[model samples]
Target: MVILFNKPFGVLSQFTPEAGHKALDEFGFPAGVYAAGRLDHDSEGALLLTDNGPLIKKLLDPKFGHPRTYLAQVEGQITEEAIKKLSSGVEIKGYRTKPCIAEMATEPENLWPRTPPVRFRANIPTSWVRLTLTEGKNRQVRHMTAAVGFPTLRLIRTKIGNIPLEGLQPGQWRFVQEKVI
Candidate 1:
């Protein structure tokens, strides 16, 4: 079975335990299923988990280059130059990212309010940017935005490959077809 979970903010990607945080069990899934790709504790979005060996194998294989799309709320007034830089790929943590698509995105009208909301600065502004990348790296989205001079205040992954969040609330999970991913 392939499971798509809308992992909540501050939740660990793995079903394992850690201090001061809830794991996947709190959201509940069948035992023995492992996440195909990981979302960091600070990031919220579509997390694919599956028990099907073939599905797992395909997702884990780097050659597939499945796209991961995110709506990132970043600090500062993001400029066209910044978007172009992002599209061209910026170096983060000594690794130069592959070229990808980056475009200005409006704040999602259907977005649910975040608990313990991002800090609001009366002077500074935040803008939404849509980022699509095929490569998954540790804190890559956040790092990439920071490298472009607009630190990410919030990051939400909306899709993994062709599967989208599709109105799943935080901490919810649903079984999906292999082809949907």
Candidate 2:
């Protein structure tokens, strides 16, 4: 069985708890299913779980280049130059990212309010960016935005490949068709 889960902020991707953090077990996913990929504890959005080992390999392998789409709220107004830099790839932590689609995005309608909330700054402005990346790196989005002079204040994965984080609130999950994979 394949499951598409809407992971919430502050939740760990694994089933086992760690460092006092809430893990995927809290969601009550079925037995034998394991996460195909992970979202960070501080990040939120679509995560896939499955019992099929080969499916996990297909999703996590970098060469397969499964696209993961994210919506990031970054500090400062994002600029065209920054978008170009993101689209063309940027050096971060001694490695350069692969070029991917990066564009300005309006805040999504019907967005759920994050618990604890993103901090607000009176003097600084924030803007949204839509990024679709084929590679998954540790804190890559946050690192990329900071490298481009726009630090990410909030991050959410809106889609994984063709499956979207739609019709589900944080902590909600549903079985998905394997054909979509």
Candidate 3:
């Protein structure tokens, strides 16, 4: 069985234990299921878990080019030129990301309030943006925004392929059946 979960901030993606922190058992999933991909311990959003290895590989492999969309809250004012640069592609670290969709959020919807909250600056403003990427790299979204001069304050994944975190709250999970045909 496949499952879609809205992982809350501060939670580890695996069921294993690490030091003094809580694990997936605290969230109550049956044994044998595992997260297909990981969200950083600080990031909050949609997480896919399943027992099927082939399905998991298909979802996580960059070769598939499955688009994953994230809602990012960035520091400072965003310029039109910056948006264009992000859309065209930004040199992140030594590698260049493929062209991805980046746009200002027209309305605030489907976003969950982050736990512990993000740091706020009295003078600098934060803008929310929707970023869709076909590749998943280590801290790619955060690095991309930083490379362009606007650092990301908060990053949340909203969708993976056609499945989304719809109706799931922070720390919530639901079983999703995928059609084999």
Point to the candidate with the largest lDDT: 2
User: How high is the lDDT of residue 84 in model 1?
Assistant: 97
Q: Which stretches of candidate 2 lie over 4 Å from their true place?
A: none
1-181: candidate 1 lDDT, tens digit per residue:
7889999998988877698767887877988788887888888989998887887788778788789999999999899999999999999988999888999999998897787699999999999999999888889999999999999999999999889998799988899865844
Model 2 lDDT-worst window of ten: 172-181
How well does candidate 1 score on lDDT at residue 146? 96
The predictions' CA RMSDs to the true structure, in order, are 1.2, 0.9, 1.9
Ranking by lDDT: 2, 1, 3
Identify the candidate with maximal TM-score.
Answer: 2
TM-score for each model: 0.95, 0.98, 0.92
Q: Is 1 or 2 the stronger prediction by TM-score?
A: 2
Whole-model lDDT for model 3 versus the true structure? 0.84
Model 1 ranges with Cα > 4 A deviation: 178-181
Per-residue lDDT of 87-110 in model 3, one digit per residue for the tens? 989999899999999988742575
